[model samples]
Target: MARITKGILGGFSGKVGTIVGANWRGKDIIRSIPNPSNKPPSEKQMLQQMKFKLVVSFLRPLGSIQKKYFGLNSGSKSRINLAVSYTINEAVQIVADVPELIYNKILITKGDLTGFQDVAATPQAGNKIGLTWEDNTVQGNAAGTDRVTIVCYCRELGSFAVFEAAAERSALAAEVTLPTIYTGREMQVWAYLNTKEKNVACNSSYLGALTMI
Candidate 1:
């Protein structure tokens, strides 16, 4: 059987250009879903709608940073501390399509500066397993000065039932991990003539997994 792993990276923000204020607004990430109706919608349309939903529920909250820091003086350096929250709930529908049978253990890694809460796991099918994580808190020094990264890994078991059914089994097992880093940017929301700027951004991210074997 073959093993597969996928990584996604996004949320890039750069310094302001000639444009008025900062234009580093958040955007949503989406996966393709088949349309049930014959004339339902085009793939682009479906994806756009999904993106809109994600922006509304996850990205819009970040706009508060602008409102809170609207009065900063011109040419004064300021940060936009925004917290964008997101959730992942993906279903493969067919585990055989994955071509891999995972067993043993799974591990997740994140920065010590962040706190993760409310982790849950569930098995939905005979050959499938599901995991969910949420509620992450980011810590930064002097507000809007810290960043956090997240990574995950899973161990495979050669003795798993699915591996047993395969005609060929290797003595070695493979481990899966997300290679890209999930980043949180610092935003300076306020700045005074004598005092420094301060901002607080808090958000959560979730990953859903379905494993076979």
Candidate 2:
């Protein structure tokens, strides 16, 4: 059995063998490990396991925030799993189809700094991801809001596409093509307004997922 240990989260955080995170209450914790019944998992089973593990590892750093957000009802990692699955759901290529989500007020920066005024994304025709956003330089202390950083996390491939919005355009709509392997799978997109002077980033906005058709 793997032993749990404390991490930098001011609480116990450890990973052993197939399990990750610390023991809490009577449970071992989230990033639930998979149990393969056979000696060697089938190709399809392997894919599913890979995806699950990827999601868990990716969300590892957000453990503390998730715990706080879930409070007393997290329930054996069910909340986190459901939340992740919901966010991972969505499809590919076409013009920006999502309703615009505007950031009108200053959101309390979560990680380090704040971000753009608004951001939205949806798949465009031809397996392309379309991103749109409004500049917030005038609304807040955006004296350093020089660029926009967008990231697309491929849930199937466990990879990312990091693209920078053109600095010259304030209300910019940018496009990025999905890899051939991504067809029929979903991706989570994230956005941030970045400045040249910070170590951390503007609180990242989860822009939803888009699956390639």
Candidate 3:
């Protein structure tokens, strides 16, 4: 790859013969398009591709939250990119050549803001979830007005139930009733605290899976 500086075409995009021109991080660059390869992928390459696929599938749906809270963006890498990388490296497990997500290791949000303390989730009647946490409003970077967010993923339904601003940090507890479709299904729950304005957030806590009553 080579940066284009005052070229005749002035940083043109799209294909120009064998090389492709494009803008990256406010700079224009050109790189040769790789020749099509007929060779098969190696085992290691396949494994890596599988892991990447699994992580992308799970995280893409949560792109809005991840982009805002996953991590600080670096240069060309955005927060969503960082989330994908982290999930692939730290949250995926392989069994018999199949990549599976370790729910406990998954992070719905990651940031420096103070997180929940001793958070717990319990299944309640009528397919509701009762969430409780210790009062940590005075803890590091925490505030009584910080709002709580909940995320519940149902693998059986291949869907998620997200509740944003369900409560405030000082409230210490909240309840969310799942949709009728989620009745009798097991869900993996997570919770996090964010500023009332939703501009900042803390790392999310995985509150364990529970079967809806």
Best by lDDT: 3
In order, what is each prediction's RMSD in angstroms?
22.3, 11.5, 2.8
lDDT of 2 by residue, 171-212 (tens): 566667777777777877776665555434455577777787
- How many Å off is the CA of 120 in candidate 2? 0.9
Give the Å shift of residue 48 in candidate 2.
21
Q: Estimate each model's TM-score.
A: 0.19, 0.46, 0.93
Q: Compared to the true structure, candidate 1 yields what TM-score?
A: 0.19
State the C-alpha lDDT per candidate: 0.26, 0.54, 0.90
Among all candidates shown, the one with the greatest TM-score: 3
Q: Report the C-alpha lDDT of model 1 over 64-123, residue by residue, as the tens digit.
A: 433342233233232221111111122111243221212111111111223233434333
lDDT score at residue 129, model 2, on the 0-100 scale: 78
Better of 1 and 3 by TM-score: 3
